[model samples]
Target chain A: MSVDLEKLLRPVDTPLPPYPPKVITLADGSKMVVRQIGRDDIPDLLPHVEALIHHERDYYDIVSVRVYAELLAYYRYRVVDEYVLIGQINGELSAIVNGRIYSPEIGMSYHTLGLKRGLRIGAHCFAAKMEYHIDVLKQEEVLIVAESPIGFRRWMIEYNLEKKFEIPHELGGSPSYSLTREIFNRARGSLIVGSRPVPQDLLDEAMEKILPPSDPPKAPPDFLAATRAKYDSTGTSIIADPKRKKVSHA
Target chain B: MREVYIVGIGITSFGRLEYPLVEIASYPSVVALQDAGLDTVDHLFVANMGGGRINHQTALSSAVLDHLSLWPAGSETIENGPASGSSAVKLGFQAIASGMCETVLVAGAERMSEVNQLDATDFVATLTHPMAEQIYGITLPALAGMFTRLYMEKYGVTRRHLAMVAVKNHGNAMDNFFAHVHTRVTLEGILDDRDAETNNPVIADPLHFFDMCPVSDGGAAVVLASKEVAKKLGKPMIRIAGVGQATDTHAVHERPDPTELTAVRLAAKRAFEMAKIEPKDVNVAELHDAFTILEIAESEEVGFFKKGEGHLALERGETQLTGKIPINPSGGLKAKGHPVGATGVAQVHEIVLQLRGQAEKRQVKDPKIGFTCNFGGFGNNVVCTVIKKEE
Candidate 1:
């Protein structure tokens, strides 16, 4: 028989418990169903991720590109032990979060992308991922890294994650931060929100179709706007008049 | 004194603006001048609070004058805390009415987002008594929270009543393209839902996250000129009929009646006397709702409703856009975003928009008289203005 190259190319996934689906009552009083999705649903999610690759604000471009690649790898069986979860508001995609099992005691955090932002949709999804690894899968720690300032504030600072400087992460070569079980447990009550056994109709609707995000983040209309912002080198005035050339540094 | 009319009004969107502080001030100046069909003014007054401390710029009016390319005219910066916007307009009114200037441009701006939220809060807290309040870490939210508690106890105002104020203003903002907060909040979202606790946390107990006005970056301007100058422009005659300002205790605790906004009552009385009109004559108003409670308290203090009955009037659908007396047709500070220095002028700008019959989607029916109360320093310094649209 010819050598089985396909078997060598695909890594075998370890059997893991499925993440229980939950529903969160959003600030708008609307119920959002957060549930795990299998590889078969990757085709429906790819277009949304691809659409956000060109968005230049708040690091969405970088995060969405990597997410697209990760989901594609998971679909093709090139990667092992991967999971995906999405927050859907009224059957519309509001946020997407994903991660993978590195080992029995360690977890790899991938990305958290909130399509409908300003309501902390990303923060809620991120909390669910940590819950999945620590509470559901019984992992000791989850390796995390923030690709955007918003993410850094939400995950690292909010949760007070520990820096595992020596351990390099898969997404970026930089050292990964560790969200230990202790840290996850401390933030669970307040940050971690959602109820088990998402209602039948809501679950059925979320799985039936993945609708496009109603409100998506957009790139700033003008980069010159940021350039015009005065940079206070020494707390001095950044918008001093040209005639006043002797303006002191902040 | 001669009659002073506002012939032009202009404003930038009240939100996180990316332009420089001076540009934020000058952008509205250019628009106001264009609206009035004038290229120059006899004087320019720029209203700002933290140009030096927050934006690291000083002598703002001079910088703004130069930035707008309007040199040689006299200019000065007016800093009166959050009331700076109306204080600048009051000065402009005096300049035009006293014949010191035939035309004047008053522009107010604040770029609060330059600093982080903590810094902005601290910068605003500086308005409180340094020794009495600041040393104890008393932010505006804390002060509003205490005031809300007392008001709730005495007036039977529930959290639902406050949420109603927020819901109304947010609904009003949905139609205002220049407003900062476009989010539509419902009573269930902030109050009834189980996630309401997390969604709208108690920022300072008794007042939730939705209760306070957002710190914003924006600019607003009004062109005040003599009646003759106004007639030459052929625009609607929205005269600055009256401008009244009053002061109260610097420390909120020092007042005998903590619930009473004395400055608001006195200033409104003075404005009404000057304008020869009662509160009932006003068809529309823009109250300083830096906190949702302020709208209820101020409405009563200004005689819009009997004391302790403002919330009831709100419940009666009286403050809506199509109600008997529409309040905050421009969304007020709650949803419109309070760029502190620009807020008072923005309030007056909305009144002008109403009097000119140009407040498109949220326009009140034939609003010939409009009112604005710009509260500053937690009611310590208050300015009230009455505007009339002449036939």
Candidate 2:
């Protein structure tokens, strides 16, 4: 292939400040390490993310498909200014977050996918992605959009995101909702979590390899599959979390 | 009077059921019939709390019997607040015990989730005294919070004890396939840690998020028959040895001692006397743990532990899956979920399962006696049942 043709196919990549990896204690007192991963790690991450494409509820199907494509673009050097952050619990993939630096002042949030659903895995991972935009790279705002009602509720409503309806997002023309530094700051103490240094052993294990998700979210059997979604709709029903997932499913 | 025995038990897992309120009752009716290998019963007792109020359907048993194609059998709806389940059991027991019917099916169900949370809470709040409590917006959690506060001060039970109850019940529920609660919450995550505040915020003062049972939609049933009928069925012979129901002041404010669940005490005493057994004879028990505090308080009220020492026993690992008198192995209301009308019947179903040695993973050690106390309206109205394994 000609150098000119290859250059035409891939957009120019911009230098991004590296994200400092951190760890957070989960509800069960287990530690989860949230750190950056590169395109080279996609081979390990793809098959796992691919497995969640059928989690029909909470729009995980569409989200997983979009996430798979975004990672593929990153792998082929087709997307510009892209960064991927992986959340691991003892070397297994828990969540993956990706976003891109759109310009000097603005950012584009691509997707946040959780192979594991509860324990706020996606919430924690989404916070890390926003942290990259408004805190790490110091972008003025990150354009965000939600494909699922859960995402709409958790991200758009929970964060009180501003409607940047005038702006279109990369995930297609769902008018974007934006997370500003002020909005990010307000949620930092409560929503944003995890600690830096990540305990050397935890970091060593997480970086050694992106292992498969131990219990990945699967297609709800039939349509009315006994799901964590029903189990999660309220607090008293919170028993549907995976610890009880087996009994509930069985 | 003839002795009544439960020859068949059936239950839909205690959680959300999108089915109509009637189906919640009928689905398990069919299962109970199948379990007994009986196509029909002489009578059916349907227990429900919010059918008319929440689901906009009244005369529930009529609908259930018709739906199950068990028409022409005598049917009635028994409504007794949250005690509807066991109250239905009592009626079925009476039917059999009086020789009015040799075989009866008592099914309990509630579609409480059909209404939104606020309306569902309001529907249940209707159980409170209208002028004294309901008019003032007194929800169950608010009432339990006050009760827990006074009990805590009097008994020195701490937040740790409540968290311990939540933790233990959650773990127990993991083994119960039909239990409503699933997650295993640690004390560190929901209590002692930095995120605990946000994670387990105070639903009521001293009663954190995990303190209360969830409002669920489910159904459970037991086929009660005469001893001869039970023996003929050739299923496990678990006798409904005793049943005791008692009511107190309709309003908590009217009671001489707010902390004492006198109804629970009296009801349990009556049940034990009738069963010819003491509280200590009960090898496995399921106390109503609608709020985590109730598990501690009811244990004392029912004589499982001395007053003020229920938490001590809880701390000593007495309530674990293999504890001395494992309570709420079905997870009680806290983890198993409380589908108001269905809970009491579900409790009796659990004890029957335990007595019959059919309670799979959450089974207690070999035991002869099991007891259940279904506390209703913050202990204003209570029903206690004792079931013994008949060798």
Candidate 1, residues A152-249, lDDT tens digits: the string is 88889889999998999988777899999999889865788778788999999988899998888765343224224456322123223333223111
Output the number of the lDDT-best candidate.
1
Give one digit per residue, the lDDT tens place, for model 2 in B1-391. Answer: 6899998788887776766777678666666666775766899999998888778999989988876666689999999999999999999999999988988999999988787667888999999999999999999999999999999999999999999999888888888877776767788877777656555668789898788898888899999988888877787889989899899999998999899899999999999999989999899998899999999999999999998899999999987878888999998899889999999999998998898888898899997999999988879889999999989
* Best-fitting candidate, scored by DockQ: 1
* Per-residue lDDT of model 1, residues B1-391, tens digit only: 8999998788888888877888788777766776776667889999999999988999999998877666677999999999999999999999988889988899999999989887899999999999889899999999999999999999999999999999999989988988988777888878887667666778899999899999899999998888887888877999988889999999999999989999999999999999999999999999999999999999999999999999999999999998988999898899999999999999999999988888899889999999999999999999999999999
Q: Best candidate per TM-score, number? A: 1
**Distance from true location, Cα of A89 in model 2, Å:** 2.1
Q: Output the TM-score of candidate 2.
A: 0.87
TM-score of each: 0.91, 0.87
Provide DockQ values for all models, in the order shown.
0.24, 0.17
Give a tens-digit lDDT track for model 2, residues A1-250.
6998998998988878899998877666677899998878888888887887876666788989999999999999988999999999989999999989989999999998888754677888899899988889988999999987667767997799999999988888879999999999998767887777778999999999888898787532221122123533212122213332121000
